[model samples]
Target: MMMNMFFYMGLVSLIVLTLNSKHLLLMLMSLEFLVVYIYFGLFIMMIYMNYEYYFGMIFLTMSVCEGTLGLSILVSLIRSYGNDYFQSFNILW
Candidate 1:
């Protein structure tokens, strides 16, 4: 009960952190945190439900791929702009 509440609160806080962040790196980090939290939630659910997690495992793999892709993009952006701050990215305008 209390553990679930704390888990949900952490998720909400991670979402707020991602939304309120101004730096690309911070936002990306928050997104990664969100992914990890989701994975943990799914893991707990699987334990209690005692069910096969084919979809969950697939989703986790996809999430890991997505994170790595995002990191690669961030690397390129940093290389081009010399910083990970959104304000530093002027290619959009």
Candidate 2:
């Protein structure tokens, strides 16, 4: 089914983000893909199961919050370091 495909794509994107630490942009892209897929899957399930509108609204809210937080974090990270590379995060005391 389409839902299953989206779920698998989200899972794969998460895995790719976890394994590849070189490109922060790629990681962000993967994160966005995962979130979108999750949203799509949830939307499909709600429609198929005849859920209430509140559930869909909640999911949309969550997706918005997630996107905002992720973009903020990415912006901060980029500002701190001139590049969007995961390896640039080095904390030393």
Candidate 3:
């Protein structure tokens, strides 16, 4: 039952990430949500399979790094352009 709930939450985050990607902050938040869901799923799987938690730790570390990178990028973008909207995020700039 708990697993199913987390699965649905992950699905919702994925849908939000797909449908509403206009703001960098929102996208990053959804990405973080997905990462959290993945970590939870991994934890549950490890418990059920009686596997070592080393992989989960690695995954969590990587996720945290990714989140920090995303936030840094967002901060830089905001500083440069004063907005987080993807509409103004020109690739050629």
Candidate 4:
């Protein structure tokens, strides 16, 4: 029960962070928070249901890949433009 509450709170925080974020790094951090919350929630559900495996391992693997890709893009952008702000990447400019 407590774990579930924490998981929900984490999700809510993730949403709020995403909505309020103004930079790419902040957005990425919020996304990471969401992923962590999802993993925790899945763990709680598995424990309560006595499930041996939730097959969410694949989902986690994907998230890791996504994080790596996002970071790589961010690094490349920063190296090229000297900034990490998403608003700085103007397609017209």
Q: Could you tell me every candidate's TM-score relative to the true structure?
A: 0.76, 0.75, 0.92, 0.77
Per-residue lDDT over 13-93 for candidate 1, one digit per residue giving the tens place of the 0 to 100 score: 677775766787788777777777778778778989998989798988899898999899999998998888887777855
Lowest summed-lDDT stretch of 10 residues in model 1? 13-22
Give the TM-score (vs. native) of candidate 2. 0.75
TM-score of 3: 0.92
Question: Which regions in candidate 4 have their CA more than 4 angstroms from the true location?
Answer: 1-8
Better of 1 and 4 by lDDT: 1
Error of 2 at 18 (Å): 3.1
C-alpha lDDT of candidate 4 relative to the true structure: 0.79
Record all residue pairs in model 4 with backbone atoms less than 3 Å apart, i.e. clashing: none
Clashing pairs in 2: none
Worst 10-residue lDDT window for candidate 3 reads: 84-93
Q: lDDT order of candidates, best first?
A: 3, 1, 4, 2
- lDDT by residue (tens digit), candidate 3, 7-82: 7999999999998889989999999999998888889899999999999999989999999999999999999999
How well is each residue in 1-93 modelled by candidate 2, as lDDT tens digits? 865776688779889989876987787778878777777777777888998778778877887888788788879888988878777778511
Query: Best by TM-score, which number?
Result: 3
Model 2 root mean square deviation, Cα atoms: 2.6
Greater-lDDT candidate between 2 and 3 = 3
